[model samples]
Target chain A: MTETRISRRFAECAAAGRPALVTFVTAGDPDLETSFEILKALPKAGADVVELGMPFSDPMADGPAIQAAGQRALHGGQTLAKTLDMVRRFREIDAATPIVLMGYYNPIYVFGSERFVVAAKAAGVDGLIIVDLPPEADDELCLPALAAGLNFIRLATPTTDDARLPAVLANTSGFVYYVSITGITGSATPNATRVAEAVGRIKRHTALPVAVGFGVRDAATAAAIGRDADGVVVGSALVAAIAASLDADGRATAKTVPAVAALVGDLASGVRTARVGAR
Target chain B: MNTTPNSLRNGPDDRGFFGIYGGRFVAETLMPLILELEQAYEDARNDPSFKAELANLSTHYAGRPSALYYAERLTEWCREKTGGKFGAEIWFKREELNHTGSHKINNCLGQILLARRMGKTRIIAETGAGQHGVASATVSARFGLPCMVYMGAVDVERQKPNVFRMKLLGAEVTPVTSGAGTLKDAMNEALRDWVTNVENTYYLIGTAAGPHPYPAMVRDFQSVIGTETKEQFFAAKGRLPDAIVACIGGGSNAIGLFHPFLDDPSVAICGVEAGGHGIDVENGHAASMTGGRPGVLHGNRTYLLQDGDGQILEGHSISAGLDYPGVGPEHSWLRDTGRVTYVPATDKEALDAFQICSRLEGIIPALEPSHALAQVLKMAPTMDKSKSIVMCLSGRGDKDVFSVAGHLGETM
Candidate 1:
């Protein structure tokens, strides 16, 4: 496989002796225009990689923060096409920042898998993180997305045992998302000691970079996790920041983009200095 | 054109797919647990001790082999409506007479036993109309395990009596207020709970839906309804009934009754979906097969009521039990393969049947199965008296009497 933008960015971050700061935001959140502003500002705000959430009506695995963000985006008339359009527009200004579209499978299934892959590739999407499609459902969307030359990143949860880690990692690319906690997003706080041990175990099996997410909230937690992980994914916290900055009617205020950007900037600094004076 | 499969019962192949419908479409955190469940269920299926224990509970605890009643008065009423030119004999698989007053206990007992076998100490379930909640609570109480039931807030108000019954049985009922505050939301909450409490908790799904093994496992446990009906009807008439009908809410009772007779080409099967006002009304009915298309939700790819963006639409129905946006995955495959016919019955028609069956047979039917009774009322009068139709009386009307009275504008 050719070296994609995601792998290249991870390598660059590794060369700097720091983990990559992976930031997530729901596309078209609050409204379409404001979401685009947030997406465009993420790179400058120190986001090494971006995960754009494709809003779906029923996000079973998500907690309240991300779920409400998706609802707001959907309420703003965001569709899979519009989400891709946001990515396409983002690519116009910044071609080096890797963007991954993350959500459940139904939206893509409804968009027609073959058609979605072509459209997503054309939109300059670097990877995908479909929460519901496991390795058992490889033929459904995973294989097709890979065939279209898009990285299909698979999640390796704490529950993924030694026997099962191989299957989860087989077709995975870009990076292995190690869910630090065994719960939904923004729920329980993960133990840093356990997370480091898991990252080491996964690294022993493959040469791929491992990113830890789920329950990562602030700069302190990001630094604690990023010390061992190749990438630190902070999603619910950023979406929560967006929620906190919204108006009472749930409309986006002037501070929405700034709030999210400030949080990402803090998390990015923490991730950059995580390996400092250690090793 | 769909070719008929040689055997309809052999489905959900090794990977838990009924054709291309069912699979483990879940989070990576839940994948290993689902695979463990699949293996555990397989072992229990082949173990005679497990079979014997379930059979014992079915007979002694749940009161299995619920009567196959001849519904003579209902049959006569239909004949009178048709001037004796039609009206086939009407029979009912009296599942409402079970211990928990519904067919839900059959599957609950089996699942609870499996939970115990898996050393899971905590039990959780999601319910729409509370029949499954009551059944889950009853089984949890029986096994001395802590139980939690997630119900939609709307259903909580409508199904007050059942809510109280679950509480009386020592189970915690959490009303989910998300989405439309209905079954789908409750299911989403339950999935979240299971994902959060993965270690010692077992999600006892209430229907033949959800991911791979659940659809197949629930179907197997509930299959006793059809197995008993087949034998009883054979003994009563020395042959099988010509037709069978049941309401579809995640299609548990319907699949249970339909699975045992799928190979019998001589018998016809029909599933009735809840049409709140009518299917033509947007988002006004729960007829996933009739008005919806294939989409993945609640862990399986099936026919779902969704919009152009693949966002699931909240389905409406007078009966809370039937108010889910998606049907079971096996039903989706069956609909695609033409093995069974799916039809919709509006609220008005079901209400009319609800009153008619109550007056004629003195049996007030639950609104869920009243939809099925509505279809039987339609099909029975068009057939000859020599033929017979069996409908699953899946639940009693006691739980729905309050809602029925309110709908009828009568103060209770």
Candidate 2:
């Protein structure tokens, strides 16, 4: 596979002796124009990699924050076709930062898998993190995404034991998303000690960079994760920030972009300061 | 009793798709847990002791082989309504006679036993009409596990008696207020709970729906209805019925009755879906087969009541149990394969059947299965008198009496 922007960015972060800061935002949250502004501002605000959420009506794995964000996005008339359009527009100015499309598989399945993968690739998507497709069902999406020259990232949870590590890491690329907590997103704080160990355990099986997410809310938590991992992923926290910055009518206030960018800026600083062992 | 080879039951294939339906369309966090569940169900199915235990519970606790009683009066009424032109023999595979007053106990009993075997101490279920909730509560009480049932708030008001029954059975009933406050929302909430408590919780899906092993596993458990009906029908009449019918709401009881009869080519099968007011009117019915397209929801691909953009639309039905937007994936496959005929029954037609059955046969059927009786009321009188029809009286109507009274504009 070609060295994509995701791999290059991780390598650059490794050379700088810091973990890459990964940020997540739901596409078309509040409105498409405001969401695009948030997306364009994220890179300068210090997000090394970006994951744009494709909103679906039912997000089974999400907590209230992300679920509500998706509802807002869908209510604002966001569709998969439009989400790809956002990526195309974002690529016009910034071409180096890797963009990952993350969400459930139903929307893609509805759009037709081959058609979605082709459209996503043409729209300048760097990778994918389809939450529902397991290794056991790799033929469904993971292998096809990988075949389309896009990185198919897989997640390893606390419940994923040593016996299941090989299967989890078998076809994974770009990175291994280590879900730090056992529960849903933003539900609780993860144990840094346990996360460090889980990252180490996953590294033993694959050469891919490991990014810890799901409960890494603030800078301190990101720094704690950065101390050992190759990437620090902050999703629900950023989504919650977007939600908090909304006005009474749930529309984007003047502070929406700035609030999200400020949070990303602080998290980037936290990731940069923390020292990690060299790969 | 001429049984052909079982060539039709081999579906869902290996990846859980019943001919382009029923895949694990959930989030990745639930993937490991879903895999673990698939494995556990496989082990349980292969274990003879597990089978023995489920069989014991079905017979001793749930009152298995619920009698197949010939509804002579209902048959006569059909003849009278048809101006004595014709009348098909009618029989009820009396699932309402089972403990807890519904066929839902068959699946709950099987699942709770599996839960015990898997060492899960907490049981979570989503109920529409509250029969599944009551059944889940009963099983949880019997198994000594803490239980939480997600129910739509609209249903909570409509089926208060079953709600009280669940609470009395020591299960907490959580009212879900999202997405039309019906079965679909309740299922969404239950899935959220399962994702939150994946370690110690076992989600007891009531119907033969959801992702892979669930559609297959729940059907295997509920297949007792068809297996017993087959043996009992032969014993009583020395022949299989010419036709079999059951109501479809996520299609548990219907699949249960239809599965064992799939190989019997001579035995025609029909599944009746609720047509709320009417399928012709906008947003009027829960008749997925008639008015819906194939889509994914609550983990499986099935015919769903959805808008043009694939957004799942809330299904309308007087019967809370039949108010879900999607049918079972297996039923979708069956409808495509021409193995089973799926039809719809409107609210007025079902209500009429409800009263007709109550007054004529002295049997008050649940609103869900009353849809089947409504179709039968139209179809049975047209068939020759030599023909026989067996319908699954899936539940008793005690929980539905108040809803029926309100619909009839009659005060208690």
Candidate 3:
């Protein structure tokens, strides 16, 4: 197992005195070729870490935007193998950016968990964020991924009180994804004051970097969360940008890559400018 | 006090797993809520007041101890129709006589009580055939909790009477139009709503499905049907019946009747699923145990109708309640362990049994239990006269009258 790229990426962002900007894209939105092109374009567009979504038939935790993106990806014949292939392709050009594959766990379970983990490491994937696998069931994928040198990120929500935080963070590695809101992604914006408090509480427990996501649709919201978190994750909003850039027939337009890149660039600027005075 | 038979009751271990099936396969956002629910259900299970109040409601409000009547005429009709090779006695565990006209109310009452204890202010549920929706709406109205029921648009059209019944019970019915407009889609929408409103809402799942605590809790509530049948059968015949049968939609009613008899080695248990057109077609039948493979869906690992790509396929059934791609995870466990036998009842078979039972026994059963009766009608004629079978008539047929009329090409 190779060393994870996530920890180094966060350390690099810390040295640069800025919160890392993390972007999310479905692996095969519209089609495989266009999706890989968008993936390659994300780094130059200022994304520090890229979270690629492996589309599943049912993404229960997602909002309408990501759900639609996944539906498009699935309609275009995206599978776990294809998602890994896209990662293999993205690693060819840029080996520095940490790539986290995020989705539900059924596909991996169907694809055989051990086989998927080995394949993911070989494909240059850095981390995993399976939304449905809680810490109580960590041995299902988390431990295996950790053994394979991939960070298995766990999500802590507002409902996660002090009594449950320890278990939630027991085996979590590389980073802790603090879901900024109680609802699905893109549904409601998080209160930065509450998020700061949650972040402070979580930092007291683990030394892992904490990234905030959910309901972060624009640069302004990203900046607000970036003030207190180690990283700012913008997922549904970027997926929505890709959706908006699609042609009338739902195919990728010429502006698809540019549209996603422009949003990531703005978000990157927001994260970079946050917490200058305090830090 | 752990009324389950010692042999087959030790499932779901500590983590709510029944063998390889039945775990909390929900989103991380719902983990806290699920843990809270698990604790709350445990506390309520131990509280005497909770049991007392639930019992009082069962006896006076929901009409518990639904009759176990000998279907003498139906038994005779079967014997005559099947050439008298077998003259097995048939009995009907009359869950249809319950206040909401189904076994669904049993689980609803128990869940609403748990919801009240947990301090939840609102309730939400998903319905397929609308029996569970009506039952849930009835309890919400009784407990003064604002209720919302998600029903597939297709089911709302086919089960209009139940839709009207739910509305009359003061529940707001939201028609879900996604993913073939069926039970599975309705559940997906309900889960979405639950994940969105996790603070003040209690998702009152109507079946023995979903994540942990649900399959077990719903079975505990519905086990009243089996418990009552056990007592009544012993009182009537001085012994337990040779076999018990029930239909498996999400398998709530079937598990209700089967769980109590699971330890009795001499008592055979069979679950009948709706085989819509046939089991061979790509999109036909809700016979997950017979025609499907084990997979994860709606927060539990169960036998589901899916394709090679792991995409869940829609199931077809004449009964809206049984038209789901997945069975309850516990049923999958039971099937694999060989504790229970699961079979399929085709549309034509259930329809003919529906008409025959109505004519012979003067009871119009819901289409769900008609599937069970279809299987019983076939199996009863093959058994000796000394042997007996009890079928759970899970619901009344009033709500299904319109659909039956349409299917039979008769005008209302």
Candidate 4:
């Protein structure tokens, strides 16, 4: 596999004093058009990385807000093809930002594991974050992803202590996504000091840049966590914010994208400020 | 709401919904398999050769066309109750008449057959009540395939008889110790086994959940219930029943009974979920669709019992079969689409129905089915006198006799 256009930019963004800004939005949200806009707009709005959520009917790693968002996307005719197409459109517009498609692994597996990788690479997907795939079955994704020059990002939770970290890292490419809590996504409370402590521990094992996610909601939380992490991954909060801008049926009735974009811009500033403060 | 096209033949449609309940809510991991299954099931179900093969197996191997006797005395007793699953045109699918003594044989047989076509030899399953395990074991034996079953440690103790039956049928039962040490744990273990053995093994999931194709496929096999009921009801009454009802666990049996008649707008479909104590408090309930959020579990995202922080919550119910944290993805889609209405039944009500049906009808139902009976009894009597209701009696009560004996004030 070759380096994705996005993953390389992520490294560049991390090299600067500015912390990486990773934004997650479910594809086919409200509708496929909005999903495309969200995907295309993230990079311009100060987001160095974007996790395009493949709308799953069941999202175990998401809160109600994200789950509802996924359901809305699915209902609005978002399929694996459409999600990849959205990524392709983003690739056409911006070739620098890292685009990672995040969701459970079953949908991808259902969509033709081999075909998915080929199409994903063609659509300009830089990395993937499958919540349920274990390192034991890395061949289901990792090998194919690597073959396509795509990065297979691994999630290491608090449970992935010393014994598991190395194996997870060995199979993982791109960067390591550190789960800040003992439980599933959207469960952990933001504890910056504790997260920073954990980040220091992870830094010793793998040279891979570590990003802490799960409870990085507000700018303060993202900034605090950014002090130790190479990147701060905020998902549920962004989905929650986008959820508010939607009508009951999940349509964006106004210029909510600009508001969402501004929020990301502000959060990006916080990450950079935190990096500076840490220095 | 009843607009989802009803397929008289089995298999998932293009959209994967078993008449608006079953659809693909999977990640990218299993898309190919789901798509392959849809095509395989569609082709096989339509082919005369395949139909004949399955019919022969059901008739000779698993014993199809189970009896539909009228529980006269039970109907009279239900005459005073609110609803009527045992009364009216109600007919037990007589799934217990099968080899493993449950309707699970229908699904296991279909899946094993499908696996054979896919050239998969090994079979892996997750069992709670052990009914599905026993069925899977029987199918693997009939097909001469290896079998593995994951059971919750707690379930292994309470359902020891079924565990023994499974082993006797040549299936290895592995006790799982994750999560709540119950159905959810078993499910996780099964998923681990599948992911580890993806090449030569087929995960024969027992419920109508887990990623794509499963929720739809399980219903396809179980759709024999709806097909049989539709034919039998018309034969008995010269018309279809006004309503059809069943207990929903992973919504498999309910979907099975509802799929055939889904296109009939005049017919209503009702599903009963495990409501634990009652509906007032969502606490301690296994009613995923009623009191759960959408979350992924056991390879598929669906309605799940989760906490404020999105941690999946283990559910509670008197019946081991109903004690699951999440539902099949199809059920979540169905709830969202308003195609089928899901109601909650408390453990007490199920227990009450268990004892009442046994004493009144001389036929005991499994605790899971008793939940459906509870709902049927709740509102049947209030229905129009001319209107008739048919509840799919998924399985017999023999296996449940032990579990409910204690709750029914009978010594085990």
Candidate 5:
């Protein structure tokens, strides 16, 4: 397979002798304009790769924080077309940072999977992480996406046993996202020891880089998890930051973008120092 | 309609697609557990002892083989409406007479037994109007296991009696307040619970929906309704009825009654959807097949009420039980294949049928099945007098009397 932006970014991070800091923020959150500012500021604040959440009305896999972010975005009239446009705008300024669109499959299915891939590739999306479409339903979007040159990133959870690991990794590209916990996002604290073991186990199965996410909040946890994994992903915490900085009316205030950027800077510093004193 | 050589009963191919409708569309964390459930269910299906235990429970515990009664008064009223020119003889598969006052108990019993066989200790379920919640709590109590039922807060307030019934049965009722606080929201909360507690929890889905094994498995368990209806209708009328009708929420009762008659070319199958006001009213009905299109939600690709962005829309219905955005994937497949006809019954029509049936036949039907009864009232008057129709009285109205009274402007 040819190397894409995601692969090249991971390679760059590895060459720097540190894990990458992956930050997730819902697109069009608080409003389309503020969300774009946050997206553009992520890489500068040390987010190596960005996961843009396409807010859906029902985000079953999401916990309370991300769910609220999605609702806020939708209440502000965020549509799939608008989300894609936000990506297009983000790509205009930044061409180096890899961007992955993460959400459920229905919106993409409604958008026409073939059309979505073409449009997504044109809009500068590097990969996808559709939580609901497992390996069993690969024909729905995974293959078409791979054929269109967009990386199809797959999530490996704690419940994915060794027997089922191969199928989950069969068509996966970009990087393998190892969910640190068995529950929904931001529900539980992932034990660093177990996450490292899981990352090692996944590494034994494939040559792709492994990124650990779910329940990652502070820089300490990020650094702990980044010690063994190739990348550290933080989503619910960043979304929670946006929620906290919002005004009483739930509209975006002056602090929303800077609040998320500050958190991302801290998490990036954590990842940069993850391997400094350990080995 | 010519009967094809192929059997309609056989479906949900090896990968669980009922002709591009049903597939396992869940998170990877739940994938292994679902596969485990499929295997355990397959093993139990082939084991004779499993069938024997389920049969025993159905016969003695759930009061199975619920009577198939001829609605003579209802039929006479239809004849009066048509001025004796046309009226099909009407019969009812009395599932409301079952233990929990609905066909929900039949599926509950089968699933609970399977849960025990799989060594699952905790039980979780999602309910709309609490009929399924009551049934799930009943089985959990009978088996000495703890149960948790997720219900929309709106339904909790509206269906107070059934909520109390569930509480009395030692079940925890969690009121979900998100997304209009209705059935779809309750289902989303239940999925969250299942994902969080996959180690020992068994999600006893109330309807014939959800992902792969669930749609097919729930249908197999509920198929007992059709299997019994076939024999009883044959015994009472000496042949099959001209048609059969049932209401569709998640389509459990309808599929239960229609599965056995799928290949019976002589028996026409019709499903009634809950049209809150009318199909044309914006976001005012739960008629997925009538006013919606196919989209993925709640782990299955089915007909759903979604917006232009594929965001699921909150559906409205006077009967809280029928308020859901999506229909079962099997029903979607059936609709596509033209194996069954689907129609909509407005809340006004259902309310009218509820009162007419209560006064004439002395059987107060639940609002869910009243939709089916409304469709029956419309169709019976149009058919020839010699023809016959059987409708599944899926639930009793004792639980709905309070809501019905409020709707009728009565203080009670």
Candidate 6:
């Protein structure tokens, strides 16, 4: 059987004795050019998968951190098309890295879901993490992405019990995005062992890989979870880092990229250490 | 019940547009937030846990299953009104019993929860009749969230009870001065609030108009009405009603009543618009359905009550609720599709219903819904005696009594 591109990408990362490092960046944050630079810098700094957040006003699950980043991005003239153009540009330099466009579905649906998926695939997005789209609501996004050969990454939180796991797993095309806690993005404390238990539980359902996110702030937390999980997603923390640059001074500054990239590198190293059994 | 459970949404690439009506028409600044709202709404709407939460709030907090009442007295009232020939049976699915005493609570509760889910702490909304504002403020109080209600200065004076109600509900009432000081102006003010406070605030639109997902999504949230009514009627009479009638302000409540009845070809759906006075457009009626042409008013391009040059015309109604310059995009779609019929009731007729309901049924109805009741009085009498009609009493008449007193020359 021909393994899907996401499965192939996961296999490559797994075979390298390293966990995949997924970084989340609000598109056009601070400025579009600066955001492009930040995206360009991630792969070199050891991010295997990059998640570009489409800035939106009402991000339901986002904490104060991501919310502020979204404000900045929106203020910076980031749009659905602009974010896609950003990806289309980033793909030119970084083709090997799996780019996961993770955000809300409204923009994509607004852009015409079929056109969005085809364009996203053409621009080099491997998967989609539409935070809450599942089987019942899958027709608008998930099914279309599956047909377009883009992985619809499903999120499984603590709320996802035995009754829900099978359906969630079924809706997923790429590696499952397991939300570690029940709360919003920045509210949870990192529970890697619990995440590992979740990953173990999920493994029984499918051969598909699992990534643990939400409150995986620092390297220690990331490694603890990445030690057992296939991929690690750092979103609100990076957003918090970016938000620090805004400060009392309204204009966004450069500390945004380094603050997040340095943490990403550190976490990437931790995951590598765990893979080599150095931990 | 071979329940395939067809969701109310159209297919993807469908744009949620029933036809050429619903589309996202917003400023560049609001583009992201609107999209986010669309996405979050889709997700939470689909998520079982989220649905359970909304359902819990609906059943427990919103006091759902707000009695499908058989108006036995009103049925005989129709019998006498129609010369005792073709008498009719009327059942009102009383949405007025919901929290805040209006069907607007249903939409406000759902949207407020969506805002909360998205970590939005502040809610801003525009109100004309103040039913939606009162509903929004109530939900804001219930959720412990800060809320802002924008009302046209004209509406401010007319709907004083509602303005006072909003203030008591812990919401800041911003009186809008622009554009005839009415619903459009209030909407402009609310949009300004959204643009300024886009980060922490969620603009809870009062009606089933505006951008793509909103018109459809709001209808979806409010669709629990038709869904409940269909079931309740089935339990009561073992069948669907011959007609579903509701008044249209921005057409939210009417859409709620009409959406479930869309697939039922046999069930006639009628929407009553406020015909303020006079016979035509120059008379200052808020009959968006009748006086409106295909034009943009609020967000989505739809049938708008406009002047000769395509400028949206000012609207007037005794009921501040019905005094709107435009209808929801989906309502325009429904109008064109002929799936649902849009009718007009003058302010005098609405007031007449207000008096009749209070006199006959001992139920004083909100002015917004009085139009529907008035229309029911007009049309139900013309229908077969055995034919059942369901009127969506969107709210109680408590808010309108004082306002109506001034009109009827009663000093109390």
Q: Candidate 5 DockQ score?
A: 0.89
Stretches of model 4 off by over 4 angstroms after superposition: A1-128, A132-279, B1-39, B80-91, B408-411
| Candidate 3 TM-score versus the reference | 0.97
- Candidate 3 lDDT over A172-251, as tens digits, reads 99899999887887889889999999999999999999999998888888888998899999998998999999989899
In order of lDDT, best first, we have: 1, 5, 3, 2, 6, 4
* Residue B137 local lDDT, model 4: 91
**Candidate 2 chain A weakest ten by summed lDDT:** A270-279
lDDT of 6 by residue, B1-412 (tens): 1223553234223454556666655433355567678899889987898888889999998899888988888788888876889766888989999988999988988898899999998989999889999999999998899998999999899888899999999999999765578888788667656755667889899899876678877888898998999999999999889988999988888888888777788899899998889447494788877877775444565777754433356778888888877888878877887778888898899988899888888888898888999888888788898899999999998988888998999998
> Model 4, A118-205: lDDT tens per residue?
9998888888888777565576678998888788898876556676667767878888888786444455576888888888888889
Better of 3 and 5 by DockQ: 5
For candidate 1, the lDDT comes to 0.95
Q: Interface root mean square deviation of every model, in Å? A: 0.6, 2.0, 1.3, 11.2, 0.6, 12.7
- Model 1, which residues run further than 4 Å from truth? B1-5
Q: What are the lDDT scores of the predictions, listed in order?
A: 0.95, 0.90, 0.91, 0.75, 0.94, 0.79
DockQ of each: 0.90, 0.47, 0.60, 0.04, 0.89, 0.02
Error of 3 at B67 (Å): 0.9
Candidates' TM-scores? 0.99, 0.96, 0.97, 0.62, 0.99, 0.60
Q: How far is A116's C-alpha from truth in model 2 (Å)? A: 0.9
Put down candidate 2 lDDT per residue, A32-85, tens digits, no spaces.
999999999999999999999998776767888898898899899998899999
Task: Write candidate 6's Cα lDDT for A172-267 as tens digits.
Answer: 877888878755677667676778888899899988888888787878777778788898888887777777766576565657668767877887
Error of 6 at B300 (Å): 0.1
Scoring only the A-chain of each prediction against the true A-chain gives TM-scores of 0.99, 0.97, 0.98, 0.95, 0.99, 0.93
lDDT of 1 by residue, B1-412 (tens): 1225677888978988898898889999999999899999999998999999999999999998899999999999899999989999999999999999999999999999999999999999999999999999999999999999999999999999999999999999999998889999999999999998899999999999999899999999999999999999999999999999999989999999999998899899999999888999999999999999999999999999999999999989999999999999999999999989999999999999999999989999999999999999999999999999999999999999999999999999
Residue lDDT tens for model 2, B170-249: 99999988767899889988998887788899999999999788999889888899999999999988999999999998
Q: Which fraction of the native contacts appears in each prediction?
A: 0.91, 0.38, 0.45, 0.01, 0.82, 0.00
Q: Which pairs of residues have clashing backbones in candidate 1? A: none
Q: How do the residues A1-279 of candidate 1 rate in per-residue lDDT, one tens digit apiece?
A: 579999999999999999999998999998999999999999999999999999999899999999999999999999999999999999999999999999999999999999999999999999999999999999999999999999999999989999999999999999999999888889888899999999999998889999999999888888899999999999999999999999899999989999998999999889978888878
Where's the lowest-lDDT run of ten residues in candidate 6 chain B?
A: B3-12
